[model samples]
Target: MARESDEVRSGTLPQATGGRRIAWAAVPEAVTAGIERLLGARVVGAVSQPGGFSEGLAARVRLASGGGAFVKAASTLTAPAVAAFHRREIAISRRLPRTVPAPRLLDAYDDGDWVALIFEEIPGRLPAQPWRRDELERVLTAVTDMVRALTPSPVDGALLGGPRLGGWAALANSAGIESGVVKKLEALSPWAARHLDELAALEESAAPALAGQTLLHGDLYPFNILLTAQDVFVVDWPHAWVGAGHCDVVTLLASVSLSGMDPQPIAESHPLTHDLDPAQIDAVLATHSGFLLRIAASAGAEADRHLVDMMVALGLASLRWLRDRL
Candidate 1:
């Protein structure tokens, strides 16, 4: 018989942003209760992790069995979008293999207002250290292998899954830049305005090249990977989509490089970066910095402001590197 506990409760779902304090309403209380009952365990502890771009409640739930799980329920302010996003994630995850360095999708529940997903917690730590040569080589090789294994999937822009070839336009549109960032970027140089104009041109030019490609890890970064004892595992699939393979490569490299560390040696040694134009490489990083800043600015929280500033600085640094490239 289906457990009565399986039915999700309405009031228990948290408001958007979870209302500042750690609240129980964000996750569907029924789902939590059901998970514990179904797993033959208890939720010994739980903590809400913040900085989520989407409307979702992410919590680390520790079970009585000494195992833990990450549970989340997403509800975009718009109902249709919430359903679509969840569906996309589920569909794409079904295609991925367990051997690949990614989190396994455990369970999914679509309860109207919210869509909940649970995944077995992968143990390990995020790489806090700088982009060392060995780490860079390892990450590049892993991504190369991951990309090679993917088969061309059908196009579904809503789900963040599609061919890898459509990257540039998607990135240009979604990288999150706005007037505030544009103004700030302009401040970087008298030529900065001209440069942004050039970027606009680049976006237009790159659109044709970006269509009908392969899948990509839309948000690849060291922080997204869990460095375990055996190997590294990538997490955070909310941004996964189909795009040019090089888009993921650029995102990965720019993410590591903008950590305020020297990436020249690592870039030179790694085959992925070895053949690329140094200036072009720098421009990609700069463009991504703007992308990150736009996302951060949209958060509107004080904590988010501080984080955005740091990212803006990184973007500015990338701009400087690119200026030298030009």
Candidate 2:
């Protein structure tokens, strides 16, 4: 039932069994050929992978003569946003010493309608199942440490684009909400509604605080982090901005809960995350819930609605676990 609910909320669930393959319009063949030629190799294989969080084409590209590269290409549909994001990533990478492991920016091209960037491939298996406490601790700790070390320079508004708060505010004021999905969210229990209200408030309150401006990964979740035998590298920097550090922290804690891990024990145990008291975690869940709701306000309204419901429920489920401690 919960899974079904999530499907409805994210708009990704409740679909027919047989679905079409996820893809983008064909990338001009010359793009791949140009990359191979630039690298002094022959193009081998270029298969597209559907990227979540951002609209782009991620290809597993190999060279006839040598190694492989992962190429992310965004069309006019997403180029302006992707270009700004890429610039932020390049700045962050430049700041770090050579030892700090991250994807090396290989090449970037702006072809008007299409903008593409390439990186040397980092190879590893995704976590096959849910992470255990130890793995969660290691991964999350690494993420926090990485964010902590970076002193984000002042971002030129014209360069990195708009404020993080703009994203939420714009979504809130938008004219459309599918009536069918709005009914589902409205039908949710008072507990869910109450939690959503608090979350909306938290997001509004946190928006101003981001004015302080620190560099944040913008999007740091399990799927975005790649773990290799040698090191952990974070990818997808489109959302990177000078914002509140806690935005990054809270986003991560909420993500851990979404991944089906209890946020209590780990939040209590990890020194890095220990600052997130029960109340703070509740607020984070609320903020995170609002985030999913906005994203699903479109065609995936059902799925986003379900995610908001689940997040509210999950936040409450953790409440009991939090009570005795207080």
Whole-model Cα lDDT of every candidate shown, in order:
0.54, 0.51
For candidate 1, lDDT tens digit of each residue in 1-326?
11222111111111112233233354557756765664468888877754333444567788888988876666544445545666677776766776567878887766556666777776666554455666666677887777766536343556564322212233334352443444443443334444454554443455433433566676665556666666777766656766545556765654444555544555566655567655446545544644544443344544434345444444444444444344
- Candidate 2 deviant stretches above 4 angstroms: 1-25, 49-53, 77-100, 152-158, 161-181, 187-190, 194-197, 208-213, 276-283, 300-326
Residue 280 in model 2: lDDT: 52
- True-vs-predicted CA distance for residue 75, candidate 2, Å: 1.4
What would you estimate as the lDDT of candidate 1?
0.54
Which ranges of candidate 1 are over 4 A from the true structure?
A: 1-28, 35-40, 49-55, 77-87, 151-158, 161-181, 187-191, 208-212, 276-290, 293-303, 310-314, 317-321
Worst 10 residues of 2 by lDDT: 10-19
State the lDDT at 95 in candidate 1.
66
TM for every model, in the order presented, reads 0.71, 0.71
Of candidate 1, the 10-residue stretch with the lowest lDDT total is 6-15
